[model samples]
Target: MSLLNEDATIPFISRYRKEITGNLDEVQIGEIVKFKELFEALEKRKISILKTLEEQNVLTTELSQKIHNSQDFISLEDLYLPFKKKRKTKAETARLQGLEPLAKMIMSQNVNNLEQTASKYTSKEVATIDDAMEGARFIIAEWINERTDIRNNIRRELERFATISSKIIKSKIDEEKAQKFKDYFDWNEALKNIPSHRLLAILRAENEGFIRVKIEIDSERILQRIENRIIKSQNNCSAQIEFAIQDAYKRLLFPSLSNEALSIAKEKADEDAINVFTKNLKQLLLGSPLGEKRVLAIDPGFKSGCKLVCLNEQGDLLHNENIYPHQPQNQTNEAIKKIGSLVDAYKIDAIAIGNGTASRETEELVKKIFFKDKVDVFVVSEAGASIYSASKIARDEFPNYDVTVRGSVSIGRRLQDPLAELVKIDAKSIGVGQYQHDVDQTKLKKSLDTTVESCVNTVGVNINTASESLLSYVSGIGPKLAENIVNYRNEKGSFTSRKEIKKVPRLGGKAFEQAAGFLRIKNGKNPLDNSAVHPESYVLVDKIAKDLKINIADLIGNKDILQKINLQHYVSETIGLPTLQDIVKELEKPGLDPREKAKVFSFDANIKTIADLKTGQLLPGIVNNITNFGCFVDIGIKESGLIHISNLSDTFVKDVNAIVNLQQQIIVKVLEVDVVRKRIQLALVK
Candidate 1:
């Protein structure tokens, strides 16, 4: 591949640089790239090995083939290991002790009786039968160990049928820190079916040293089969050597083969689990929008009075009230007046009720009030609301209001800007993502942070409503300066223009350049704030509009003139042809929310649990999760239904994810519903 083209996008290469990737799809091309890198590295390694072997006069054609055919890094290294210089061992010593002829004679099985075979080698060096037997056993062990074919066959067979075994040692022998491994002791399970979570659990346990574990494939049948194959003809005289060879295969070969089997199994598990997590993350970041809602927010409570905050169409909180809706029976009159006035005064469009303790009761009250008024309302998921409420961002924004009022604000803001509000809280606290804690924390944090960044950048921020927490998530800024910007704004009053952001502490030209376009300021000095076109691109926009001889207002959404512009003319090396083309397309449809369809899905009102489902009953559901086992659809939040791997197919389905995806809208028929455990099994209806 050309180095220049290598750095380009897969989409670009697949469409334009066909010669480099051979007209392959994105996935196939990615695999080819990875394989090519690995092959090149392998070739370099082979050259070094060949040079050394040639110097030693040990390089042979057969040996070269074996080395080249090694499938992985481990197997390649293993192939080179025997020829590697090492310390003296029992087998090496046996050869030096003049017992080679006797060992080879017994391996060929040229004698009948054990004692007779032993006696035939009765020289001074192999003086006794015991000494002769010892040398013979060591050679046989080495023979079995070196047979790569036997090793590969046994490893494959073991993986098909082996059980992993472990035993916990006594407490006194192991430290207190090692006690966690005790549970894994004496455990036995098939390697193929074990999950990644469980595999890692066992690995952690093994690291603690309270357990001795082995992957034990019942190789009795295989050992007997090998004996029959290798021994060829059986004789009473050769029986002793046969027994010794079988013992060597069992003691020396089985464990090593089992280790290889486990490695392969773990690799497969990691691939599957990684794919599952990545899909889940992508789906979560793609949750539907409620758009810009004019919300009447209710922070549900009982003892502590419920805080009511009303926001405008742009999500700026316009009114705040504290009501004892669920408690303080005497305060009922005051509560009614405050709530009624706010709803009527601002023409509060929707009641964004928090799903908290008094949420259902509050919903009931809103339903009664809005029923006559023709208002819409939705019970929003209030996950991590408390975290947001107590946060510094919340306090900074709504200093006059208490935590309850801040919570109410968050609920309203979340409805208006899910991506913006969600970024403020930790993703783990949001209850999405994976076994986040168990995985490499730094890696997980990096990935999750990227997901949030991508989502935020895709849906540009409203600079006026954005808090420091929200602004930090914008392309260039971070938490510290985001806070500084908010502080500066608080002191300086509402930012009238995007250009004024440079006045904030440490907000230099570079930061402003990266962040300017994404931080939209509606009704700001520049009309481009309402769109995605940056201030740096303001000249470009004016130039285009000038050439077209139309006003900037008329220039937008007019596809005919926009398409005629040569993007290559404006493109610099820093901004390539690809980037210029994308910018032009984006400018055509500025401030577009790059998300999946913003469709609201409501489950059956009566069906709160899986027990309410019936087999063959078709239900319109949202795909919550997709795994190798099957797709899981959420009829309601209480539980999701599983469509097994078998049911994921009208034809053969190798990967269930290929058939369906996370957060996708699909209809599924309930196949089995278990009420007690709250498991719902569903199959795609179509």
Candidate 2:
């Protein structure tokens, strides 16, 4: 609590102050932070409630005690419902007409003749005994509806046994666009057991004007339950109480409780969808990087010639051009000759092709052309490449180039280093999430931002070449500081050491302390600056080096020397075994990237589109998107196939990720094909 109160970041406290947090991981620490925020909100709500009650002059001893002891919002609201100011209702009209005494007489259930008692309160407003009794029942219904015990009991019943039903609007059933939701035209399910994806789909259908949804339960059972609680005696007024009980359940209780149930269900569905999105986003961000290499990337198209760019090992754009090798302008010979000459001239090591229109044809064309070196060709997802190309970041990076040229460059850079390149684009635009638009946008952004931050800090950043978007995710560096660092680098050259960052305008000691450890400068004067070791721990590293009788450079990456050093000898009051062990590990592999090296993937050449697919035919595919039901795999075609959770493995699969991951290449057997709708179903090949 104190650590969070002091505005300590999760990574800092988890890594440096292990003893205080009991060695909690980032996820556990995040939970604690979330709970603390919720508690603070609850306290504020309590204060507001107390103030409102005091102003109402209804803060009696019993009411005050109950309000103070309430633990949840539902209970507190239930206690406040009777005292809450309401609009003019039938019950309020009856009360204003001097019918309360008759209503009270009926409520007591001790009156012998209800008609005789009701006649005494008769007036111009209540002209007859039947009118007086009707007014009394209206008041009684409101009274029964506001009872805390009654509302709580009904809520429990709804939670345990509600059914959600949906039906298509007859007039819109034949609408072409509404056919996409045809599966949900007529559906009913237990609200408690509906999966998140199904619920979200149903809600989307409802929102699109295709279906009307309703929540219901056993009406007779609920009415009996309410009647048992409200009626106490079998007298003349008991019948009037029964009428009131029915009115309460039908007009008041059912509608309100059903709405509450649906709202809760929607919230749960949003949470589940957001969790899946975060997991998939994390996996895609941490996908393998094809380390620094001279490469050529192409954005394939038919009418517009393929946009191509050549990038150096440092991902700097060296050259770009347009090639017409497919359809309309098939200058095959000229294209091949130009590609070969450029590869030879630039010493290219690999080729990257965007998996869009004409991708396979371009790959075939590139493979046929021979080069001096063995150039590996890779097909990468172009989900957000276009978005980045048209963004301000792209303009800043390549002010002289057009959007097409910038986009081709982005595709190539992603192949070389995915985390570094993809961070420049928004996570939502990456197209790996499910129902992202339907869920809470603020919450989705928050989760995605955290995931990106964790990935960036885990892999560490290069101080000299990182873009502002990537650098902004560092522990303490925000947009302004990131821009400053980039500006300083551009004006004065590369950062030579960690302390040089402090010299940038608006960058103070605190920002440097939080961000320095995650920013690495290769071949710098201070070797620790290139590693995860903090500047605060440089004195300890110097001590270890001095004890070993060698230069600091010699101590780094020397496993033999690192293995012999006792971490216990370096422990101090603030530095414990965890920090010392981390330091030793960092020294062994300074600035080691956690992502794997990217590999080349290929699809079956004979199959180019959905029409070419056949049952029992084996084909290679890459997982493109994931959801609760299963994953969508791109099989080198315009239409991706669905690998339902039931078919994700030969064995029963409970979790989809336990078997496959985003961007993972695997062979699948075609099970069914619906060419009309451009859909394919596949089974995992064992």
lDDT of 1 by residue, 101-189 (tens): 76777777766666676666667776788887777777766776666666767767786888777777676345766655556766878
Candidate 2, run of 10 with poorest lDDT = 7-16
| Pairs of residues at least 3 apart in sequence or in different chains that clash in candidate 1 | 112-237, 113-237, 166-186
RMSD (Å) per prediction: 7.9, 1.9
* Cα misplacement distance, residue 579 of candidate 1 (Å): 4.5
Off by over 4 Å in 2: 98-101, 120-131
TM-score of each: 0.65, 0.96
Worst 10 residues of 1 by lDDT: 3-12
Across 1-686, the per-residue lDDT of candidate 2 in tens digits comes to: 89877666776666666868778888899889878887787677777877888998888888888888887777878888887788998899999999888888898999987788889888998899989999999999999889888888888888899999999999999999888899889999999999988899999999999999999899898788887876889988999999988988889978887898888898899988988888898899899998889999999998899998999998999999999988999989999998999889999898999999999999889989988889999998899998999999999899999999999999999899888899999999999868889988888898888888888888889989898999999888989999999999989999999989899999888678778889999988898999999998999999999999999999999999899998888877888888888999999999999888898888898998788999999999999998888999999999999999999876888888888899999999999999998889998774
| Model 2 superposed RMSD (Cα) | 1.9
